[model samples]
Target: MLSALRKYLILPKLIRLSWSAPKNRTVAWDRYWAGIARTGARSDVLWDSGTDHELLAYRDVLRRHFDPSLPIVDVGCGHGAFSRALTAYSPRVLGVDVSPHAVARASGESAGVEGVSYLARDMTGPGAGAGLVGSTDANVFVRGVLHVLDAANQAALMENLRQLVGARGTVFLAETNFQGNPVEYVSHLGASLRSIPAPLELAIRKLPMPGHFGPEELARAMPKDRWTLVEDGAATIETNPLMDAAGNSRVPGYFAVLKAKDPDAGR
Candidate 1:
């Protein structure tokens, strides 16, 4: 208990005393997600935090195009909130995250949603060389996750994802381009507590983690042969673009889904 407080509160403040803007936030996850329980004013933050409006719309668009029933697998699905949402339309969904605590919490509270399940796994997919033996009847998504890794890891993870999807599967993705929406720009705005660095933004654009492409770069990474970029999907936060003054002004991201070149490979 003392350790948790010290680490989250005291230690972070101490670090802040000498803090340079956090250049590498892959490590940032350690502290960021720790305090995300059911207490904040945005009680729904845990349940529905995506990159932005466009991305959320991407999810919805995919929901309309893809079959929610084929057992959708959401990789790095923090609290399974999206999985639960998927269940509303499709009866079977599964969420996976690297954090076991996240999985346990999601699975325990979400027990009533008969078809949805959250489980713990390395989640790195194939590049780690660990064969996660299994296949899904539907699509596999990596929303809000690619941004956290280094590019090589991202490549390995996506390659693994491709393997899981086989020749005929779909993949959904959402990530931040720190280039345009650096941390300092939007950190203190709405619900997030931590701040980021401008350098992290420029660097990711120059060298994104594994499949880490900008909105347009997404086309190069997946390639049409393995996966064709489907139109962006709909997200929970689909809102008016004109509402920019109402949004976090700085960082902008979108939700997107991809269909496999051969639709039948995953099924």
Candidate 2:
């Protein structure tokens, strides 16, 4: 009964924060990560998908843009899943997340993994990537991050990505492009009062409600004058919960490959 009441109280807060003005969401994400870590069930997170196949499906698409010699930064890399997979190609991989607890958890899980490291840094602030500026020529990989940020925060993140990639490196981002009302969307993903997927519940009850990111959003976030979009297309974002008879749970997604335009090259 107490648990039910607690959940009842959380949903309203979630709705409020979802529409609130964009600010530093480091606290919210930190809280969410801490909570998730306490659950001790890592594979059940909504975005985990519990398989490397998710990244495998995009490996070919990414191979066309990533420079194998360059270090890869997996931004918003919760638990370092993709960071580990990236080691198959890149000699060095850095998994960065806004939550320190998340970084610790990922580091703990990836203890013996060679060529992989983790950092906790918030990319949604001005001058966020100053420490990483020297990581020039480093490629970036972001999945399911942009849709959780508003335009202002998105632009800030893009600036940080620009700084990290420098001149020659590229960035690959994949974001959910869900197009439905929040209630309908959650319901379709298998949420209910009786039983909600832990990760989805955590997102709805704590983190910012997700938004959409498609071609237009990409154009706005990384304008052609400053960034070049090398490639883009439709994709599917797999989830860990709510499998159907086909044994899969997925959502509409979009992926883009981009490179920062050099200021000196044009002259």
Candidate 3:
């Protein structure tokens, strides 16, 4: 009875408070993630049960597209889940993130895991791409990070990836779409709602959320002069039985594969 009351009644109030909350997104995310680090929790623990599907989808993409012999760089890799996963195939995988706590936790968790390492570095900073510059065979993988950045930061990130991957390298990006239908929105929200207690979820939701972009907007955001889109399509992160207007299943996220137009142009 109390659970029902909190879910139906108290939840609405908390959601409202979350909308009105005044918090800097970067600071809030750092602090929130710091708490996760201290607890030594796996990043997936924050998501609903179905997040495993998304992880599987990512693994599938990697298997089909990623070259095992080439170095792999995972940008904005929180807690190094995918980075650690890549160690099975690649001899060199570097996961970089802006959060020191996240990097430290990831490094500690994956310590002695051959072929994988974690670094605390902001992709947007000057010379941040220096280490990976001119690696024509490298691949840069970014997921669940771009939508959170502003335009300038996003551009900087792309530039960094371009440098890391070089002219012939490839880039894979996965991001949530803000223009999803009501069902899609609910599906995305349900992940958090199911995993977190009602009141706490509500409080967390009130904090500043990340930005979302439609497919066209994402295409426009890419640096056309440097990268050429190879493939892009709707991706289902969670199974939804419902169909959209086009009779296709609704998905909460999307993915893109881009190749450098000129691998040796800016070097």
Candidate 4:
């Protein structure tokens, strides 16, 4: 009964948490890269729960849409394990993040790979990089990022990415799709976090739950020609690896593959 009550209390909080940025937490967006330099790109303490197949699927998409030789950007490229892993398939990969800490961590971790690099950029702001422009030259990966943003921010980010996609590139978006409990976890592949960038007040007024982008949410967010959703799948599990040792759970999330609506053109 107590557990059920706890869940019920957490539910409304999850809703606001899904859309608002953390207030007190101060992700340190400006100096986001500083810590990565100090720590030397480390594994995400929060996401120790990753898998081989998720990495493989990402690699396959890179191979499918863009050339291994061309440039690619991993937007919001957290610890960048995926970028490091991609080295097997591509010569050049770049990871972008808004947090200096995340960028530093990803860069430090991904640095050894010959063709991969890391940068820091606001998802809603300027020149993410060469790949941000799509110029028949690079592909952009916005994995596990956009869905966390509010609708307006998500739209802005996707539009910016669309510009980067140019005519012949691909954008792969893996999200915590909206099929799971906002208070518990996300879809088959991802879950919601009660702890977010936003703090208590923000939590009260805005964030109450974690989130997933609803179906058509992307389409509504982006222009028609700018993106084409190629394939989408969901993974649901009661438990799995994805949280900290002391506090993680196995929950499912959603994954999707998208290329420039015109595959031939992004090239």
Q: Cα-based RMSD of the predictions, in order?
A: 9.6, 5.5, 6.4, 6.1
Tell how far residue 2 is off in model 4, in angstroms. Answer: 8.9
Task: Supply candidate 2's per-residue lDDT for 71.
Answer: 90
Tens-place lDDT per residue, model 3, 1-267, is 674334343345445546754476555555555666222222222322212456577776667777777888889887777777767657888899887877887798787889888888888876587765233468888877787787778877777676777754678888767575332343334422334333234325533555675467565667678778877877654322221223232346788888877756544
Worst 10 residues of 3 by lDDT: 37-46
What is residue 71's positional error in candidate 1, in angstroms?
A: 0.7
Which candidate should be chosen as best, given TM-score against the real structure? 2
**What is the per-residue lDDT of model 2 for residues 101-120, given as tens digits with 9 covering 90 to 100?**
88988888888999999888
**Each prediction's Cα lDDT score?**
0.51, 0.77, 0.63, 0.55
Candidate 3 clashing pairs, residues 3+ apart or interchain: 18-206, 167-263
Q: Model 4, stretches more than 4 Å misplaced?
A: 1-6, 9-21, 24-44, 58-61, 126-136, 178-181, 186-209, 235-248, 261-267
Backbone clashes, each candidate:
22, 0, 2, 46
* TM-score attained by model 2: 0.85
Q: Write the per-residue lDDT of candidate 4 for residues 162-212, one digit (tens) a residue.
A: 556665556767665645454444322222234432112232343224456
Error of 1 at 172 (Å): 2.2
At residue 135, candidate 4 shows an lDDT of 50
On lDDT, who's better, 1 or 3? 3
lDDT of 1: 0.51
Once fitted onto the true fold, the runs of candidate 2 whose alpha carbons sit more than 4 angstroms away are 1-24, 38-44, 133-135, 242-248, 263-267
Instruction: Give me the displacement of residue 162 in model 3, in angstroms.
Output: 0.4
Summarize candidate 1's per-residue lDDT along 133-193 as a digit string, tens digits.
3544456766667756756556556656765565545677766544433223233222123
